[model samples]
Target: MQDFTRRATFGLGAAALAGRAFAQTAPPGGIPRAETPPFAVTPEPGASLRIIRPARFVEPDETIFRANAQRFQDKFNVPVRVDFVGWEDIRPQTAVVANTGTGPDVVIGWSDDPHIYAEKVVELSDVAEYLGKRYGGWAFLAEKYGKRHNTETWIGIPIGGNMGPCVYRASAVKEAGFERIPEDHDGFLKLCLAMKKNNKPIGFALGNAVGDGNAFAQWLLWSHGAYLVDEEGKVAINSKETVEALQYLQALYPAFAAGTLSWLDPSNNRAFSAQEIFLTSNGVSLYFTLKNDPGTRAIAEDTQHALMPKGRATVAPQTSTVMNAMVFRHTRYPKAAKAFLAFMMESEQYEPWMQGSLGYWAHPLKAYAASTVWTADPKNTVFRDAMENRFWSGYRGPISQASGAVAADYVLVQMCAAVASGQATPEAAAREAERRAKRYYRNT
Candidate 1:
């Protein structure tokens, strides 16, 4: 609201994408400054490529996708066919296509398998280096997804990402507060606890939705000041940070609405509609939910979001970052496919296509992120803010996906069942999670 990003620095490491969160304030320069790459690139004339995207994304307008297709074709003397697919189907289907020699050159789907170094997708190291040479390089991919900063090999690019945020009723918080809403995790959780004592719902409901359960684990990771992985690629979730995070959740459960375990994203929306809860942490879908429901729309008119409260240790899972577009190994048009992939990651076609599709994806290209043209849209600003400070859960590397039964295995799901139902002590649940995650850590 108050030029949020301009004043804040995000990523915790150097040469890491997180650092890009802060605007570079010029030092009393009577001298003019150089332009940022994201803001400066021009479409390559006679430069075009073919790209296949997830079908779920809204296709381009009669004007943009088609005209651009022709423009790239005419300019680069290549054809760009834009295809779509349901995200779930894109991977296996793409794999089959790749295996059968019929897959698309580029894919648009969720998750980035960084550990799978030689898999179908491209590692961004070469591209990151190229961008570094041409334009200033920020760790576009490094700091993404809570990964240790500045190591090499990025599997996915962030197109549009969602952050774990506490979307709350502004009016409700003003009603509960001692003046000035707190952004610290402990303070906010305390408020949630107090609200519950008064029989007020804290807006948390994850029933029937693995996503809410999924989000709960992530918020816990952030609050605990622990990470899923350590710098050495070893799993670290069983440590102090994770246990502390579990305690935080256990402490807050009593204050959540009565049927919280049954709460999903919709439950929170329902509570918001009924004016029953004060806050809940979740992704951008909360905005979509607000727009779709009539009663919620009224509540939406007053709802506000903040980055999920920062723990003493700063962390948040990169939800929806690391979009992968791979060149199928058995493709008929291998060279074209590779070209298309390179181009897709390039900003020229990337920006307009996603924007035209009404896909609220953030720019995956490091250069595109610096664009004033891209950030000029206010709808994009909060996203821009979320990107710098946030990260995706480091998904399994491209060679193989994590065997994480995320919906069922996610720690939050277990915590809610344990703490909310009074089945176990918070400490007990934390110990159990550590045990389960240790197995996953070994395998992953």
Candidate 2:
């Protein structure tokens, strides 16, 4: 899911566009053209986005995010236009665009942070349910998860998704003398100890920067049978399960690549790429790590991906679909905007989205998931099976907004840094994290 190796699947299958799925009318690497009757949406014909990026993607295919406005316009029979801006000027220039409300028909690619949720993004509950029922009721998962959110609003919908429990080279684990993947929390720790004796870092990202750590930590904490919030919607990181997961990681840290504290997306990715670390509890970014990079791809080629080893924590990964898309309150054409949003949440729209985002997003609409196509696709359906009664919109806590999330990535990193650097004890770090979480929830 990191910027570097995640393939371009959204616009994939368009003729020869670098890496995306082929849509019906796609001309070799091209965007899918709308098959519906050419129904033009006339919104006074004024929509645009600063054709700029803060950190532009290296691949030329990345340009399609902006380049394809014409397709959206043609399909909707609207006169929407794409405005050009270099990355350097994009952010500052947004003030003028946003303030004037003369921006693009829909924003492209810059969604992250709670601002997207709180401000005006599309909510797909109705669409999710529609797609779910149409696709065989798997669409219900979206509304089930999205409904009654802490925010009293459905924030976003995921177009594609996958979760990795714990990834270890099967051979590496057996070489370390474990017969199979650990079945519980303690077994995982023992496996780590064994690997440490042989000098291998238990390969989960711990740098508390952003995406990587929160996701990794969530899987571990859930496996260990704990979470950031208690049953009372209060901070619970100090619970037994939390402590066990915390110490397990701390004890296993030294066996990992040196200076892991300084690690984030790239450095830790490099370690995994080089086969310097094994047994990372992470998502499927390993696909790229193993396939793309020249250095690590060789070893990664032989690695086996496995379900996250179960812990005393048996819960499924919490769905991020709760907050990826939102509808604008000020949308000039609410019906048309809603229609587009509706299309996005449906199984058909998501099929393309899943391939495009490289599965970084999961379908928030359960309706879309029930599609035979989704259930049948090897890559798309694995997580669907795991989602049975396992998914959560977000932590069931006082924090009302799904966007008001304190990702496990940041929490785990700060905790590890404390103990690894001798800056704090595991217990102390846990307590501080709890205190901070409590404050965050209360304020939110």
Candidate 3:
């Protein structure tokens, strides 16, 4: 499989720090790279703070981020260099620069990134508390994704998150003889089975889909009351709930289209847009893409989103990316970095940024929920209640380096894929996954 994570491109601007391009070259892990748009901020003489973040998959959203950073620079008179890295490479890139004390002053990364770089980043308790008090408090998931378990330290500030609601063609569901979408596990299975009769197979990423695959797999396991680990970070995958989850996946495997096992983040998007798929789990990116394109407007109009169906247990699906901004201790301008983050969080700046995303970025702050963006569309509102359901890969386990390791390695997704492909029995897959997880959680 092509390494989607390594295929990230850098966006270097003319005003980039020291005129050096942080653009693409294969990093240590065999990850590939690409270059993004030019650097957005033009640093003044003697102004030298730099921030690195994942470039949005949507080009317009990336522009919004750059514009917002420029706002910070114009207001604070601090020339901030912003480097937008690819989603697959951001974590590793952050790790490399952070450990060596030479990365950006600020970084925006996915869930558990704060946990992964907890020691190397500055404690953000003061910043978090200030934001919490001023913004009517952080949402539960924000707190969960931003801080270490059982500690007062805030490793990063949860800004916003990307949601993975079940995106489907509403027309397809009705054609399959369902009055509404499935609400329970068995009902959902029956719907998929029905959809299969017409060859409109349900699609979920089975391969190295860093976001969709992991989020959907965890949702399946959690719905069955299974957990990858216990609350304290112990390996707890070998169980009835887990076995049932795998078996459930195996039963549904026949309903998935061919090549699903190799799908990455962009695969389902293309499939849905082309009308080749009836159902899949993904963010609003697919919807937004379709909506913005005149040629695909029909598909966009027909698309709808909902929460993952319930199983033996009722819980919200785990979010794929709980986005946060981290400041490194090695930053020569810690104060400037913090100010930039805080300035960006203000309602004036944050709302417009979310608006530019067109429902792709949901608010991590409760107060921001009242933004018109959430109510502008049915697809957006359906995900409002889902915002609080977000959980990192560590879920029942503590968010630590071990939990981060498991997520980065795509452990649960691989386990489910193994069963679905008949490569291993559910029991064997569960046991092997447990063994692998034990190795990751060894020190924690």
- Would you list the C-alpha lDDT of every candidate in the order shown? 0.49, 0.49, 0.74
Cα displacement (angstroms), candidate 2, residue 49, comes to 6.7
lDDT of 3 by residue, 158-210 (tens): 87777787888888888899966676778889888888887888899988777
Ranking by TM-score: 3, 2, 1
Candidate 1 Cα lDDT to native: 0.49
TM-score of 3: 0.88
Model 2: per-residue Cα lDDT over 183-273, one tens digit each: 6666767887788777776766556534455556666567677777754566667777767777777776666666667665445555666
Top model by TM-score, which number?
Answer: 3
Residue range with the least summed lDDT across 10 consecutive positions in model 1:
1-10
Please, what is the TM-score per model? 0.65, 0.71, 0.88
User: Which is better, 2 or 3, measured by lDDT?
Assistant: 3
Off by over 4 Å in 3: 1-47
Q: What's the alpha carbon RMSD for model 3?
A: 8.3
**Which number leads on lDDT?**
3
Prediction-by-prediction clash tally: 28, 53, 9
